[model samples]
Target chain A: MLRIENLNVSIDSKEILKNFNLSVDEGEVHVIMGPNGVGKSTLSKVLIGDKNYKVNNGNIYYYDENIKDLTIDERSRKGIFIAYQHPQEIEGVNNIDFLKTALMARLDKPINLYEFAKSIEKLSNDLKLKENMLYRNINAGFSGGEKKKNEILQMRLLKPNLVILDEIDSGLDVDSLKIVCENTLEYLKENPKTSVVIITHYPRILEYIKPDYVHIMKNGKIVETGDYSLSLKIEKEGFENIGTNIIEDNK
Target chain B: MNIINIVNNKISNSKINNKIKLKENKNICIDIIDNTKLYIEIDGINIKSNIDINIDENVNSRIFVFSNSIDSKININVNQNKNSNLILNSFYKNDDVKENTIINLNGYNSNIEYNYSCIGKTNKSLRINHYFSKTNSIVKNRSVSNNDEIEFEIIEYVPKGSIDCNLSQSSKIINLKENKCKIKPILLIDEKEVNASHSSVISPINDSDLLYLMSRGIDEHNSINLLVNGFLVNNLNLNEEEKHILFEKYIFRR
Candidate 1:
């Protein structure tokens, strides 16, 4: 479970989040739909403790703890995960190595490479990822779909309690989107205590993985909160018909 | 296990009778061999020395050298004859080492593949000189260095009128907790009809890479360790299990 109170985030002296507040209970999935420049991606990054977004006035709480003091990696270790819109292309950093290193970080002993390799192969297969890409540099030359699947592969390997997916369905084709959404739903089913927060401009993925709550972000704030029908409304009618102007999209 | 092992050096120029000769087509697995003195090749001999290989016309051979030492220097010269092919693999882990490998593709249509991996505990230097003497000779060199300096040089010459020879050099260096480390890859091509290119990377584990790894619950130091190990040892020609052991005992020190 995660909670935010009166959060105002800014980057380079430009305001991004204006008193944004939201809360998601355990075993729940929440989706945030908005037009361009509505701080949807910024909120996801802030939740994962990305340092680029400076919190001017706010406090993020996870369970009973105020995560304001936690570092980026600290928040990640505390069961907070974020899937970026564009995963970085890292050369010479193998996917298996990255995953195993992250998995080993929680342990005090040396990593069991053989078992780690087996688990990775199994998870990658479950995600329909190429086994060879696991050996290559992390997302170095991967296609957009491959990048999305790789993100899911990390989610499977990491199994964090709270998953934040930012534009995960943006670049995926129909088939890849289905695979990603199906795997995500499967992961949620396995971890009933887990929660998901997806930020997107389209509702196609909501058709695959329905959310219990939908929030429409505008002008650095959530202006409306409703159920899955909110996402459907934004899908049929654009954000303009949702009582928000294009001029107010970015603040 | 590594391909080459370094044992005690036996042949010294201090004595006058240090010249060593060998039979043709002979395969040797020893601690050390000083071909300058201990190896001799004569005509009409079916000789194939695995170490210090020399491929004559229409000959194809492969060699492996696995070396481990505190301080040593080994020089290997490979000469490819007309229409000949040679593949050489070298792996060395040492504290102080100075090694120079000279490869000459002198005959027409000769080809060679050379790969070397080295782990440096202290100050060490490695130099390689590759020569393309005749037409249509292809040469490739790949080297990996960890913890110290390496100067890899390749000189591809398409002797006037020599046509369509290709040369490639790739070198990677991982410098962590290492302040005195550097890599220099020099490619010298002397002909217009030849294709030659070289790339040398000397870098620490980048900050973004560390952040990416740490975002998955890995700490900063462990993230750097993982990145260094991946850069230095991944996708190499040696044994992964054996290399993992080496990392635990020696490289990782845990």
Candidate 2:
């Protein structure tokens, strides 16, 4: 459903992603494991069409359509969603209002307020978010866990076809992580065609949402691709121990 | 809530409500002796007026001043007695408007909270003088200009012997066009045992915030509109009806 061919991305004249390649089929779950500063998050930003990340080479394909020139909003309307590593705290923008606007834009039609409110209430309850949070500004004064849950709520509401979760488990507690993963799993069950790309530093979240493939990213490119066992191997012996032999063997 | 109207230097008091049609070159005086809430509407064109307000001791009052005028100059003076509390919310939209406001805390434990929002060419200055101990003041001003320049100067002064006073001033101006905007927040404290803070920002709508909103599939124009609405309407101490009126008249109309 999503394809990146020889993607070379840079910001401020410094290259971040060089010769990066990845592919995800419909209904596939791909987990990307990488250490800090390995350009994992940069890949996610590039996928979402952040203008700051200049694509110096290659193209991004969404369902075989080249989306390299699409704007951020255009990519979002095309069913591409990225849960940011650090969600922005926008003051004065009410959370419910923002979600309603987004939903309207995504559907390209005005929605029934009653249905929208009901769905928001149910989703807030499922995510263990306080009802008052719906009235507050977007992510303003929200705890780290609440911000992550809010992102998941938007994903469910928007029903994107391709989801890129950048370090979704960074600030979540055990229960919050469980709730978030369960919500995601429920969403996937309802929409079987949805594809997920999980970006993380550890295999903790993988225990909840099992992945079809695990790719280890280093220096802005995927070095090794394996099944779930690769995540466990990397966990047992850190990224430093994953040597050139393993990369060659995997290739 | 009492609604008072002064039209063309004439006063007609009703038990419930009225309107204010300010006349050119006029002086208006208002004295509040009891706890009351007031909604004052000042509507005029090319008028100059001076208003004096006095609040008696131990009284609590809230006033909302909605001014829709053009090419007007207005001066407001307010005095608060002991243990009085006042909340003033003022909104202005005009082609050219100059407003000067001075507030004096004449007694101990008096408090004043002032909120001002404006659009178009405006020059506004406010000074809050703390004359007694334990007085408090909070001043917040937000302005937006599409073409003409807008300037705001807020001064909070605490003289000597006015110990334990708290003063704060926050001012921001959003210049949508190429017009230059200014915000000057000054805090003059002669007392040692007082808390004072001031912050000011004058810029266009934040680009990162706009991008964040747009990433949710909202177009750039709508995203900017939402941001401008939030910047003007949020954090104002207004009731539902007042907020709706402000939104319809000033924010949405733009």
Candidate 3:
């Protein structure tokens, strides 16, 4: 359902991603594994139409339409959602209010309040999130695990066709991470038509949600693409020997 | 639906005889709507404005006034007797407008809270003076101005040995256009025992924050609107209807 080819991105006259290529079909999950500062987050931002990262050369297609010309909201309307690595704290905007606005924007119609509350309660219970969080401001004073659960809750409510989870398991403890992984996989199982791109440096998340494709990103480009076994290899042996020199890998 | 229906003002000095006095257990509320205008001038000589509010008193008043000429000046004195409470809010914004306002208080055991939010985007000048005498009174002032055409000055005075009084002043201005603007907030504290603090920030939005929001589907105008709303939300004590009217009039007027 998603395809990116020959993507070249730069920021502040510094080249980051060079000719990266990847493709994920429907009912498939792709996990991008890479070290820090290796442009994993950059790829996520670029796909969501982040303006800071300039795309020097690339073509991204969702379904059959070119998404490079689309705005972030337009992309979101087309079923693209990005769970930010660092969730922002919006003080006065209630979490339920924000989710409703976003869901309505995506659906082009006002959601039923009763159904919304019911679904949110069910999802929160499954994700182990506090029910009182629905009335509080979005991510305001939320613990790291709480923030990740909030992201997943949004993902569930919006029901986007393509959901990008960026470093969602980093700050979560073992129990919370297990809960998050199980909830995410359950969502995917329910909507088997939906596709996901999980971005993380570790493979522990894979223990819960099995991925179809595993891609290693070093520097700014995708150096290797393999089945789920590739993820295990990267987990066992570090990314130091797989790609070229670190500088050339960065090129 | 309408809180204060009509505003009837008589500018002549004879109207002073019918002036209303607030008792120690009373509360007062005044509202304005539909192109209402009021011009008040205080000569700054022997001012006696006293109102006895009750404990846990609630006073809601909105005073909107602007000067058309350069020589317009108003002196206001409010003295609250001991153990009373008051909340005073003020908003100022005008172009090619000049006005001077002075407030003085003399030794009353009252807890008075004052808030001022000034947005001057045009050619204007304002001089404000505030002096307090009693202890344990708290004053908070927050002002934000856009554009560079307006000149503003604020002066504060805390008398000697006023203990437990706290005052905070915050001013933030953004120079969107190329015009000269100056904001000077002066705090004169003669009492070392008082708690006083002030802060000012004058600059445009950070490039990184701007980029961050823009990347999240918000354009420049919407980003600025969010920031401006955040800046003004704390001082907004409007009811539901008033808040709706304000959003319709000023916020969503585009």
Best by TM-score: 2
Off by over 4 Å in 1: A107-122, A130-137, A241-251, B1-4, B10-68, B89-93, B119-161, B174-184, B235-254
Q: Give the alpha carbon lDDT tens digit for every residue of B1-254 in model 2.
A: 66655443334442332221223234677777788777766666785667777888998988877777778787889999999999999887778989999999999999999999887899999999999999999888988878888988888889899999999888888888869788888888888999988889888888888888888899888887778767766757876577778878656653
Instruction: Please give, as one word, the docking class of candidate 1.
Output: medium
Write one digit per residue (lDDT tens) for candidate 1, span B119-234: 66333233333344443333333333444555544444445556677777676656555545555555555567777776777666577777777778887777776766655455
Stretches > 4 Å off in candidate 3:
A244-251, B1-77, B89-105, B116-153, B173-182, B203-227, B237-254
Best by DockQ: 2
Off by over 4 Å in 2: A243-251, B5-25, B44-49, B159-161, B176-178, B188-194, B239-245
- Selected candidate, larger lDDT, 1 vs 2: 2
The DockQ-based CAPRI class assigned to model 3 is incorrect
TM-score of decoy 3: 0.75
Indicate the worst ten consecutive residues by lDDT in candidate 3 chain A: A242-251
Q: Candidate 2 vs candidate 3: which has greater lDDT?
A: 2
Instruction: State in Å the error of residue B186, model 3.
Output: 1.7
RMSD to the hidden true structure, all candidates = 7.4, 3.2, 7.4
The candidate, 1 or 2, that scores higher on DockQ is: 2
Residue B120 of candidate 1: its Cα lDDT? 65
Give the Cα error of residue B40 in candidate 2, in Å: 2.3
